[model samples]
Target: MKTIISTKYIKNTVLAAAALFAVSATAQDADDTSSPFSLSGSIDTYFRTALTTSDADGTYAPEGASTSFANQTGFALGMANLIGTYEAGDTGVVVDLVFGPRGTEATFENDVLNGIINQAYAYWNVSDKTTLTVGRFNTFLGYEVIAPAANFNYSVSYLFSNGPFSHLGVKADFELSDDVSLMLGVMNPWDTNDISLTGEYSLGAQLGLYDQFFNFYYDSGRNGGLGFEVDYTGGFDLSDSFFLGINAAYNTNSETETGFYGAALYPQITASEDFAIGLRGEYFAYTADGFDDVPVIGLTLTGSYSKENLIIKPEIRLDSWGNDFEPFTDNDLAPSSSLATFAIAAIYSFD
Candidate 1:
């Protein structure tokens, strides 16, 4: 059978894939290190294969990578993440750098004259309730992050893949109470490290209560810019050995009326001291003005084993789409709505 993929999906894929990928505050900081002036980093490598897809002729555009990172075929290098932080009294600075396939993709926009940079910012704790930050930093938008060790599943989710990876702006973080917090900032658009070529600025805000966050981003609509995004992320511990994570986001551009939305659940069980298992079940969809909604469901199962600072993850993922969207070719070389993949990754961190 033959099927014509819609232009909307293509546009959405390109747009989402270009993101360095964004994140949230209540989430663990990918670059945070113990103590001050500590040099820490991680190295990751993986072996991935398409379970039920054939890519001999390279006809499938995304092949088996529908999300982000860990999509490269065969044995691949994820990236080298190096972070340096210095905190003295109330002031601190962080220089986070990355290099490799995953790093390149994460810093797609900042590769101009400065190679690859994951985040570079200076922060100061003001008073007991407020803090100020400036320079480029990872976005406070999604559950997943740029660092491999920070995620339960090596393969990123559609929600994280489509959001802004990092931002070049200034922000203020306020601790309202023992359990409440708020953060607000303005920046030169998404993924831009230098000046905003469009001369347009974007706004970001996050409100945290009892470890749950409500995030928002906004910009004027024109020439395919970001109009707004609303996101919610949180987690609950059902028991001592089991936890559930929830994330949902919606984004729309008023000018083009094009965007995406998604929700995902991460349920994990710590089976032993050095082993854990998790599942990421997600539903993601794209919306456009003149096209039917194209929705996809992704399920990823991952097993994690750790010894000291080294971790190994084995993952299996499957994705199926509706609205006649066949992004993969089956083993029989036929257009198919579903794709399966398997991968194992080795990650080591040092300080």
Candidate 2:
């Protein structure tokens, strides 16, 4: 009787697994039908280490320092995006629903998933060269973005996040030629949850042109003034790989005017098909109108090797803000002309 019971339990487990596999296969086949819905999303993770030092022993202190010498580790899981597209001949509609982690939050209440509708919008393809989109959507402003591999610089730059993350309004996109495209939109100036300010709205425009080797973008928001950025990526056969990017923007508010700028350069040498070494350098500066025009600069040097989907990166960085800014007085760290940090990271991607 005991032997018979054990065999029955094993048989039930196998039957359950078979049932799940059949259901998954059926769902996949259903997706292959000419239905109007699709699902796609990506996940990204990174670890960072930040360090600071002062010229005087008591001048500066780290805000959130780890006790271990190892760099701080952070993990994030993004919600899988569900996209729906309906086409009734040439005229069609498309909608996107985006959900994901709300950054490095400590609790579930603050996660992006709490906002059920990350993105809800509609679009119409008026013609082969024109499209109109209305609702809440991501902005097309800078070169770097929330996407991981799309950016060579590890962390978010001051200009990228300071501009605009999303817009709630209407936008028109036109493809002028093979190499040129333009986008014009008017938005609520803030997130979807915020009410529009009286007599205040934000208008933005962007123009882009390039062939991958070189690209240029010009964008401006009513309140953020105008910004111009350019990127260049090209290299000779086996000599060297290089990339150079720069951006500048100026803004004026009722109380003050500010200027922001950034530049970065990366050069790599591929010693073998699976082995490479690279160096990255970046700088940022900010100046305020009425206050002392103090500037801040940050730099990073990295060495990386990649094999298929695996990547290993080791980096060192330094940050410094001009004397115009006040320093922290209560920590063991000291504020100096510059602070340095060292970190190593590994990543793996699967399909």
- Model 1, residue 199: what's the lDDT? 75
Q: Write the per-residue lDDT of candidate 1 for residues 1-351, one digit (tens) a residue.
A: 111111111211111112222111122356763444556778999988888898763222463336777776788899987777666889878778888889888888455645577778887878778888888777788887777776778888989988888888888888788888888889876666667778788898888888788889997523556588999887777777887888999988878788899899988888888888899999999899899988999999999888887889999988889999987889898989998889999998775
Clashes of each: 8, 7
RMSD of each: 9.1, 13.1
Tens digits of per-residue lDDT, candidate 2, 90-159, equal 4444444334442221111222546544344566777888877777655455434433323344444445
Per-residue lDDT of 40 in model 2: 33
* Global lDDT of each candidate: 0.76, 0.44
- Pairs in clash, predicted candidate 1: 20-165, 21-164, 21-165, 22-164, 22-165, 23-140, 23-141, 23-142
TM per model?
0.87, 0.63
Whole-model alpha-carbon lDDT for candidate 2: 0.44
Which candidate leads in TM-score?
A: 1
- Residue 30's lDDT in candidate 2: 48
